[model samples]
Target: MMPHQPSQWICAGRFPPPYDGQSLLTQELLELLSPEFSFIRADATARPPEGRIYAPGRLRLRRIPEMFRYIHHLRWLTTRYPLPILYAIFSGNPLGHIRDCVTFAWAIPRRRPVVVWTHNALLSLHASPLWHRTLHWLTRRATLFVFAGRSLYEPLRDILPEEQIAIIPNLVRRALLCSQTEVERKLAHADVSSRLRLLFVGHMLPEKGGWQLLEAAFLLRRHGVPFQLTYVGGWVTSHDASAFTRRIAELGLSRQIVHHGSIRDPETLRQLYLSHHLFLLPTKHPTEAQPTSILEALNAGCAVIGTPHATLPEIIQPGVNGFLVLQHPREIAEAIAHYWHNPNLWYSHARAARQLFVERFHPDRIRQQWIELLRRVQQSIPELAQVTT
Candidate 1:
């Protein structure tokens, strides 16, 4: 008897250049699932023009060529494979959705199964009613829709069947997980007398709460809290960077806070996470979903402090792994002060955070979910079902 061959999938989505949560998660799926499956890469990464930064969300005329390149590749890849499962990220905006609708139009006619990954929840809230109805019509073309969290299903709940929707939380890289020895050493050296180290890892944009975090730091300083806040990301632009610097100086948080720019090296980032006692992301970004930074912090045994936005409330348990605060500076400061007064409480929360990561976002757990979801998808197709069985 011959062994069964791995199923071929045309996995199309954003791969890293800019390295945001969605792009990283897409990369994670491709790398981690390669053993059981084969993939034909259709890179949807919107490469920026020469000497320009790649920003996918911004509306620019230059992106038209990039979109055409992706569409052309996707069409060619689909033709090469025999009934390949079309796994791609479902865009949240009308322009992107229209592009997707056109690119995957071939699959729709042939009744090929497409797995749509939903990483953002902004389309339902921010899009116009006409676009919403259009998105609803376009979304039905997919055989299945995967969501990052349970709360994220609300946007397409009314339009999609219950069986078509599957909840799968995003997983962070395993390298980010600290060793038992490292965790022990970190906790041992972290004495109540020492300064509490707080870390924030994301773009230094106002919407991402960089400014709000600085304001909270000022409030903490006024209350005489002993802490060091490190910002581990680059500003969106030189102008934003300049504005941030001016604001930091004006708030007199230059001494208490520091920006380390963007650290891409995994080992260095892992080390930073291990050294910090708290991870702060008071983001009010409209398109926020399940952020990988929160999971990274959880893996390193650092208690998270974030707003109850998107799928955050599900990820954070108040007084357990972390605290969910309002998007206001005062509330963020209060959450920080909660840990300042009780170092032991912070330690307990840190342990709980690590435990939550182990139980919830472990690589094995995430892999199993993907395998099951893929198996179900394969079972739906007659030819693929025969090959699997």
Candidate 2:
């Protein structure tokens, strides 16, 4: 028998530049899916001007030209790699819907198989009815819908059949994971002697619960708890930044809290996770899918404390790997105190956190799931001859 040819694919999504969860997850998909399969890249990153940052949710008029450039690139790639399976990332906003519509407009006419991947559970969070209608129309023809976690299936359950939907959780890079020996040592000596080291790693916005976390820290201090809370992300807006500064001084938490802006170095981030005993993300953001920082903390054996939002409950089994709390300062402070009062519980949960990562979010497990899903997508479509240059 002739050797089977690997299926060709056109993987389309933003890679990085802004380095948010979606882009980083897209980068992970490329790394795991490449080499074995041939692909034509259709990058969706809008390289906004030097000083301007790319915001995924907001509609920027200046970026319209860049959108056209993206469409042109995809058109050129499609002509050359005819009938290649289209795999794309689905953004949750209207601007993102328009981009998806344009991308799908080409492939749907050709009857090409398309796989749509979404990293957020923002469909139900949209205020307008049009965003809902638009997404339903755009994804009506998709061959498969991939979700970052099973909890993310609620918004799409009515639109797509259960078979068409696949739940493949996000994967952490090997470099970010700690070795078994390292995890053991870290778990054994979790710095219970000193003040507890707590970490918060997301945008310093109110919706991300940064303000709530600060309030939680104040409550912890008021209870005579000796702990240090560190903030490690950029301020989303000038108003939020000013408010954060004023509130920190108001709460008298300058001595107990530290804000390090944004740390882009992976090694620095990895070390931060290792050194901390607890991770906090009480986010109520509409676009949060799976916070990768939680996975990093789990990998580093830091017990997590987060709000029960999106896929967080699946990641954090309350009283096991972590505790999921309401997005309130009192509840968050109580959860932290729960760990602080019982050093043994914290140690046990820290080890359980690492075990959970290895069993659920490890690269090897996720890579296999992607391989199987890709094979199914490839098999469902009829092969087409490649265009000769």
Candidate 3:
């Protein structure tokens, strides 16, 4: 990273504590870029339209009135540093997407180097005509669009300039925060043959493959493979959670299947990841960007078993770090059984997973990428370099 490059950037997005992928990425960039770049945190709460636009608690007509505040902040950044840019972040949510789009649209002309950092696939998702047009408008105006992964940028090939897009991947943070030696100490002597400790850390939506894990559990039980699958995170629908509870009862496998509800605390979540031998995310959720859970699993030195989708294929190399199985019970069952049969396999994979995290998603690598991208964006606008120099 260019520590001496007089660049002041603003990272505007949802930061951590909500304990999700998007928020975690925002937080990672915010902290990683702090030392080198003069960064301002524009914590625009992209809450859903409270009632209606400008109504009792709506988005207040694009928050356009707040332009004075943004301009003031920009002036302050320029005075304090050299090159001032806005790294506005966005996601797949329709309401938040529109809000960010509008905010960037207004800020683009005024702000020297503005980047729209997207954490998910945009072109693939469905949106209303109005929101769709607004997004396209923002895309045109944005100095650059940063995607979480290259696969995410594939669909936007035609619409967005190739030069304007970059992928830094959803890097891991909690893994680095924890004591690496302590985390690997448990894995080094873990007995994967005896009752396997499996983890599923994602929303309890059907698309997340919560039921498929249950089916795999049944098969593993029938095969006499001792294993425990714990489902973490909250349910999307109350009906689904209730139905899942009943399904566990009907199958008489409540004892084997554990649900920790939603784990928000990072330390607690880190410990949970450390205790488990395998992390399972059998999700076919189409909107799945680079999942932060898989990265967390790797960082915690846990082998992964996720379905082939999104960033899973990129990271979960078959028989390497984790198994990217087809979205089915049989595939998942076979994978669980494989690890149970060969305990040594877990050690090798655990090593590989941690190595992958350190090499690809480490903070040092992420920091350099952010610095380069920021520099690239600043260079695109001739005035930014002149002003900073």
lDDT of each: 0.78, 0.78, 0.72
TM values, all candidates:
0.93, 0.91, 0.82
Error of 3 at 34 (Å): 1.2
Cα error, candidate 2, residue 129 (Å)? 3.0
Q: Across residues 257-365, which tens digit of lDDT does each residue of candidate 3 receive?
A: 9998777667888888888999999888756778888888888888999987877888898899889888899999999898889988888898898888888977678
How many pairs of residues collide in each model?
0, 0, 0
lDDT of each residue in 1-389, candidate 1, tens digit only:
22445776777788877656677778877788878876777877875433234343567787788878887887776665554554656676556666766776743334667788777674443357767666666667778888889877775567777888898888888667677678768777886445778899987767788788888888888888888899987655778878888988999888888888877678999999998999999887777778889988888889999998888898899999889998788899899888879888888998899888889988779989988898888987788677544
Model 3 misplaced regions, further than 4 Å: 1-6, 46-85, 107-111, 125-136, 174-180, 386-389
C-alpha positional error of residue 359 in candidate 3 after TM-score superposition, expressed in Å: 1.4
Instruction: Give the 10-residue window scoring lowest on summed lDDT in candidate 1.
Output: 47-56
Q: Pairs clashing in candidate 3?
A: none
Task: Identify the leading candidate in terms of TM-score.
Answer: 1
Off by over 4 Å in 1: 1-5, 49-56, 106-110, 122-127, 386-389
lDDT of 1: 0.78
